[model samples]
Target: MSNMLSNGISGLNAAQVALSTVSNNIANAGTTGYSRQSVQQVESIAPSNGKYTIGSGVDVVGVQRAYSQYLTGALWSSNSSLQAATTASGLTTTLNSLLSNSGNLQSSLDTFYGGFSSVASSPGSSAARQALLGNASSLATVYNTLGQQLSQQRTQVNSQIGDAVASINTVSQQIATLNGQITVASINGTPNDLLDQRDTLVQQLTGLTGASAVTEGNGSISIYTSAGQTLVSGTQSYALSTKSNPYDPTTTDVVDSAGNDITSQLSGGSLGALINYRDTTLVAAQNQLGQSAVALADSVNQQQAQGLDLNGKQGQAIFSVGSPGVLPSSSNSSGGATVAASVTDVSQLTSSDYVLRYTGAGTGTNGWSLATTGGQSVSLTANADGSLSGAGLTFNTSGTAQVGDSYEIQPTRDAASTLAVSLTDPNGVAAAAALTATATKTNTGTGVAGAVSVTDANNANLLAGAKITFGAGNSYSITDGKGNTTSGTYAAGQPISADGWSLSLSGTPASGDSFSVAANTNGLNDSTNALALAGLADVGILNGGKTSIVQSYANLTTQIGTAGSQANADLTTQTSLYNQALGNQQSLSGVNLNEEAANLVKFQQAYQASAQVISTAQSIFSSLITAIQA
Candidate 1:
């Protein structure tokens, strides 16, 4: 009876414990990060009475949590990828819409270029000229608006990056604290709740920085960044900091605890995605737009310079744009070294940023090396006056610079934002060429001169004009305004350029053939320049004359659209994968109320049976004591 009572008591204790465990699981079923738990039990043994060993009822040891390290790690990784894709997708979509939707660059460009026809058809009409100017102003406004919006997006993303860093710091500190608490609690019993809290914090941290975590032997987790920098270890956690970039102050950099820049290493989370999008796609798109603006303005201005306006005067610049920007790095020496850049050839320009580093002393390629942001090196040319020229730009360096000093050269980054129509008066639109060519009646054979295109607007005798006379063997002699003659043998289909103008001579010409080049007296009635300006819409003026201004802008729009589409698709796939991972992890660790309810009934029945056993043992002992007394 004593053995029976002891066994019953042990059974009762085990049953009660099992019921309590089920109740706890039911209570926390809706809790996030809660792991399902069960009471661990085993059969007990008692001292044997000579013959066979007697078995006790049961024993309650501990409660165990249903969790798997593999599942949880998979979930964390998927979440990080999902967050990165989400951020990148949003940014690219917004940029694509800005370039492709209605009221976009292409739409505004169409209206602007279409106005050229109106002005060309009626060069002297004030209404037509004013309409063209209106369109020009509208085009400039679009460029400015687009540039400003892109800058605003960058500012917003920068703020978001700062916010993410702060959140990461907070999460890391909490995780460190929990790690210590969990380690200490494990000495007494399983700290299931504390362990869940720590894992939740780790998940949050991973989303921000794509950090990885490892469980230690002492029941604590160690967290590390994607770049393998330690974020948390035991009770100690290192912090991350943000700093301004030396090359561009507006840009930001992520630094480790020891002040090492880790911006490039954080390539796995939402923060990384934002930084990449801002630096690559956003910057490239903005620069491409500026390239078109610069090329368009330069080409039109050059053509305008070679013509006369409605008042029959030399044409002035039609548009003004931002000049090349040269930024000395903040880390540059205090030697006051300065570099100023200007665009020298629009056709040779590219939508890329360059870094100019001083190496020693050589004028062109000798003293400095020029490389694009993508690490491509460009050949540099020596100029007479301590200037360097490359990639359609001329750089004038002054003052003193240390051997490692560098400057960020942006030839067209801000051009779009600063583009504007410089001429306010309708008569300022140059509509006719300054020089006209005519064939002399005495000429025989089929020889004719095409329209004149000016090579140098500032030529001393540009307006004074000249005369060309053909001789034997297709030879030609040019006489300038002062009657200074130069002889040259003409090449078939080649332009005979002199007095700052170029003209092509076609058809066979007999000896003694002559043509006179004189100033145009057509006034506002002449539409020669207007016709040329209108035809500029089809001329390849950018990218080494491989693409027109409008085509370049279109290419930019297409590239962004394609990138955005791909980003969105990636986000969709990542989201699906994340969902699957989360579901799998949850199925392994999540509590089910229905299951706990069944466990409650089972434990209740066991408790009742154990109580009955104890009662029976007490009654039998009482009866035996009574019998002995009788």
Candidate 2:
């Protein structure tokens, strides 16, 4: 009877313990990150004779939380990817809208070119010249505004990166603190709730930094970035920081606690996306814009120099473009070397920053090496003029360069922001060729002189003016502005080149009849150069003749649009995947209220049955004692 009572009490104890575990599950069914707990039941050791043994009541060994490492890891990875795609998509969308807008660079370019067309039609009209100036100003304003906005976007990216770093630090510290508590709790007993909380914190951290968590034997997790940088180990959490880039101070880099840059290795997270955009897309777009601005200004300025403006002087530069920027390396040792950069061919400019590193001194290519950010190296040879010029850029080395000294040359990064029209006067507009071809009154030829045009505008003789005299057989003799003469025989239907000007004589000319080429006294009405300038719109003069000015801008807009579109698509796809991952994780570990309700009722019945057994044991004991008394 005593053995039966003992077994009944043990059964009651085990059933009550199971009932409590079920109640706990039912109570915390709605809890986030909660896993369903199940009781591990085993039979107690039974008292035994030599031949046979009697089993004791059940014992509650442990309560295990339903968890899957694989599912949790999948969820974390998917969330990280989703966050990165979302961030990149948003940034690209904003940039795309700006670039593709009707009121942006394309419109400004059209208006600016239209101004030249107007001047070509009526070069002397004050209204038309003033309108051209207005358009020029508008074009400069557009470039400035675009450059400023791109800079602002970079600033926003920097701010976001800083915020992400702070968030990572906060979550990492929380995880480390929880790691200590979990280790302690594991030593004493199971702390399933704390484990779930720590996992939740780790998931948050992963979303921010794309970090991975490694489960330790003591129930603590150590976190690391995709680059394998240790973020947390045991109770110690290593925090990330941001530092200014040496080449561009406006940009910042992610660094470890020891100040080692780890930005390039970060991927699959919001922070990584922002940094990537700022470094690659944003910089490239800005440089492309600046390239267009520089090319436009240089092309217009060169053509303008070739013609005669209303003031009867040679045309001055219509726009002033910023020069190439050379910045010394921040890590350069004490050196006297100062590098000076200039744009030799704006048409050949590329949207890349070059690094010039000083080697041991020599006269030619041995003195220095040029490398692009993409790791392409060029061995440069010096020009005959003793200047180092290559890759569409010229670098003049002043003073002495230390062997390790380096300079970063940015050819057109700031050109757009610094572009402006320098020609303030309508009369400064170059609208005509410098010299005109005319027939002398004594000429005995039916040939009428065609309009004099500058064949080689950069020729020194074209500036002061030249003269062409007709001879027998439609031939001509040239006398340059410096009084140097060259006589050549000509055909009636063929063209003639004299003193940097080309003209064609169509009719027969008698001997000794003169056709003179001289400076245009009235150039305002001569729209020859204006027409040529207007033709720049249709010419393939930029990107080494691959595209026109407007085409270049169009290409920029198209690229931005394409990039944004791709990012959006990736975001949608990643979001769907993340949802599926989350759902799978939830299905495996989440508590179901209906299931818990059934468990509650079942455990309730179990508790009642155990109670009944206890009651029966007490009744039997009471009867036995009564029997004893009788």
Candidate 1 residue spans exceeding 4 A from truth: 100-102, 362-364, 458-460, 471-474, 482-484, 621-630
Cα TM-score of candidate 1: 0.95
What is the per-residue lDDT of model 2 for residues 146-203, given as tens digits with 9 covering 90 to 100? 8878878889999999999999999999999999999988876788889889888888
TM-score of each: 0.95, 0.90
Q: Can you write out model 1's per-residue Cα lDDT over 378-496, one digit (the tens) per residue?
A: 98988888688999999888888788999999888888889999989988888888888889998996988788788898787888878889888988899989989988998878888
Cα lDDT for residue 201, candidate 1: 84
The lDDT, on a scale of 0 to 1, for candidate 1 is: 0.86
User: Cα deviation in Å at residue 554, candidate 2?
Assistant: 0.8
